[model samples]
Target: MKVVIAGGHGKIAMLLHPILEEKGHTVKGLIRKEEQADDLRKAGAEPVVVDLEKEDDISEYVGEADAVVFAAGAGPGSGKERKWSVDRDGATKLMEAAKKNDIERYVMISAMGLETPRGDDVFQVYQQAKLQADKALRNSGLNYVIIKPGRLTNDEGTGKVKIAEKLDRGEIPREDVARVIAEILEDDTIEDVEFDLLSGDDEIKVALQEFV
Candidate 1:
């Protein structure tokens, strides 16, 4: 299967690229900065420079992809307005592009506690932006997997994973989260379902069995 990642430079995407490529699936990364392209290419994913906020310019790429993954996010260094633009509006635009291209399978990586974004919260803007994008994917009538991961860390991968359908607040490894997304691409049982994810020491397939 061919998979197109919207944010190839992201932490989860970094983990996913190698795993997907090793599994023999063609991978393409939608990137913004030209510098990211070299990194993505080195990771074995074809990189396409396309800003998420202006996806109309790259509708052709979205149309050709067999599956789409929304793994991009505005970095911590970016301002609040940029979060809204890249996380909220940018995600919505990608979903629109998916619709226009008739792409049915989509996976969106979101935050664990995104439903509420208190003004004083340090990540309030990010929460709001993610909530909007996540909600859109939930309502989008496609084979979608919305994986909301908890506080991300740079810890080395443990491969253990968990899947909760409702809201969850478990800490998950970025690598573990990436594995879940890639596993879903191969598993058909979780079709049209959304799950909250966290790090564990067990295989994601075994962890998600009940939900499936």
Candidate 2:
């Protein structure tokens, strides 16, 4: 399998690259900066320079991939406009590229509790943007999975997670989220599934069994 990850320099994406490579999958990472290419290469992923916000057409880069993963974000330091551009518009554009290339499998690294209001003004707008992106994916007619994880921490992964259509608010390590993404990619049985993910006692593969 060939997997292309947007925002390949991201914490979760970097961690995920090795897992897919170890499983015999070719990994391509989309990065905006040329300097970030070396980091992705060290992690065993081929790097492609493509700025999601500026690129009008990305099918040339994403075409022929088995799947595409949207791991891009505008970051907390960025303003509200960038939130809509990178998070919302970036995701939609990837969907369009996927359709143009006839790639159906997609995994979205979305945030949890999009329906609830908890953050400040800017964060609220971020939530709204994610909500809109998720809506588009549901209507996109693509085989997709939306993994909405709670507050992300930098702690080491426990290799356990609680997954459900709706899960209470909680936190999970970035490593765990990367592991889950790799798991979902390998299992074709998981399709059109949207879930809230959090740290839990259940094993990753076993916890996912119920969803399948």
Candidate 3:
């Protein structure tokens, strides 16, 4: 399968690239900066430089991929405006590109607890943007999976996870999240599912099997 990921230079995307490649899937990452191209190449993905914020049409960038992943974000340091552009509008464009390119599978890296309100100022805007984007994908009539994880950590992954339609608020490592995405991409059986995730005693594949 061929996969295209938005925010290809992101922490999770970097971790995910080699995993997908090892599984024999071709990967392409869409990045905003020319410098980030080398980093993506090192991670075993073809890097395409395209600023999601400036570009209106992205079908050419997504070209001939089996799946698309929206891992892009407007980072915590970014102001509220970028939350709308990168988090919301950026994701919207990816969906459009996927449809135009006839890509059926989409996996969204969304935030947990978006239905409830939290945070002050910019954080709130971020939540709203993600929620809107998730809604758009659900309505897009595409085979989609929305992985909404709790507080993310940089700790080592245990290769275990607890996944459900809605899991209690908890934390999981970024490595584990990347592994989960790789597994989801390889298995076409998992479709139109949205779940919250956290570290747990169950094996990742087994836990996902229960929900997907």
Candidate 4:
């Protein structure tokens, strides 16, 4: 599979690149800065420089790919505007690009517990933006999978996870989340579904098999 990931320089995405490469899939990462190219290259992904915030039409940047993953975010420190732009608009743009390019598979990295707004004003906006983006993907005619994980941490992955339609508020390592995304990308049987993820006792494949 030829996979393109938005927010290529992100921690989770950087971890995902080498895993996909080892699985014999071509990986391309979309980055905003030319300086980030070397980092992506070292991580086993080709870097395509395009600012998601500034680009109006990003179809060309998306190009031809078997699948696309929306992993971009405006960050916790960013204000409300960037939340809408990068998290919501950027994802929709990729959806449009996917439709235009005839790519059927799209995977979204969303957050768990976004149904009800919470947190401070900016965070509430972030939740709203992410929820809106997930809804757009659901409505989109393309084959899509939305993986909504709980709070993310930098701890080492356990290679085990629990997945369900709705999971209680919990946390998972960024590495494990990347592992789940990689698994979903490779498994064509998993589609048109959304789930919450967290660290657990079940092996990654076993947990995913339950969904299948």
Q: Which number leads on lDDT?
A: 4
Alpha-carbon deviation at 145 in model 1, angstroms: 0.8
**Global lDDT for candidate 1?**
0.80
**CA lDDT, candidate 2, residue 127:** 94
Clashes of each: 2, 0, 0, 0
**Model 1 agreement with the true structure over 1-212: per-residue lDDT tens digits:** 88889888888898899999999999998888888888898898998888886654456766566678988888787778878888888777777777778777888887776776655544787888888788888787767888878888888768787667764566877878887888888886677777777886568888877667
Colliding residue pairs in candidate 4: none
Model 2, 1-212: lDDT tens digits are 99999889999999999999999999999999999999999999999999998988888977688899999999898889988999999999999999999998999999899999777888988999999999999999999999999999999999999999888889999999999999999998999989999999999999998766
- For model 3, where is the 10-residue window of minimal lDDT? 203-212
Candidate 2 clash pair list: none
Query: How close is each model in CA RMSD to the real structure?
Result: 1.9, 0.8, 0.7, 0.6
Pairing residues by index, what is the TM-score of model 4? Answer: 0.99
Model 3, range 1-212, lDDT digits (tens) per residue?
99999999998999999999998999999999999999999999999999999999989988999999999999989999999999999999999999998999999999889989888979999999999999999999889999999999999899999998887889999999999999999889999999999998888889989886
Residues 1-212, candidate 4: write the lDDT tens digits: 99999999999999999999999999999999999999999999999999999998899999999999998999989999999999999999999999999999999999999987789999999999999999999999989999999999999999999999998999999999999999999899998999999999999999999976
Cα deviation of 40, candidate 2, in Å: 0.3
Worst 10 residues of 2 by lDDT: 55-64
Estimate the TM-score for candidate 3: 0.98
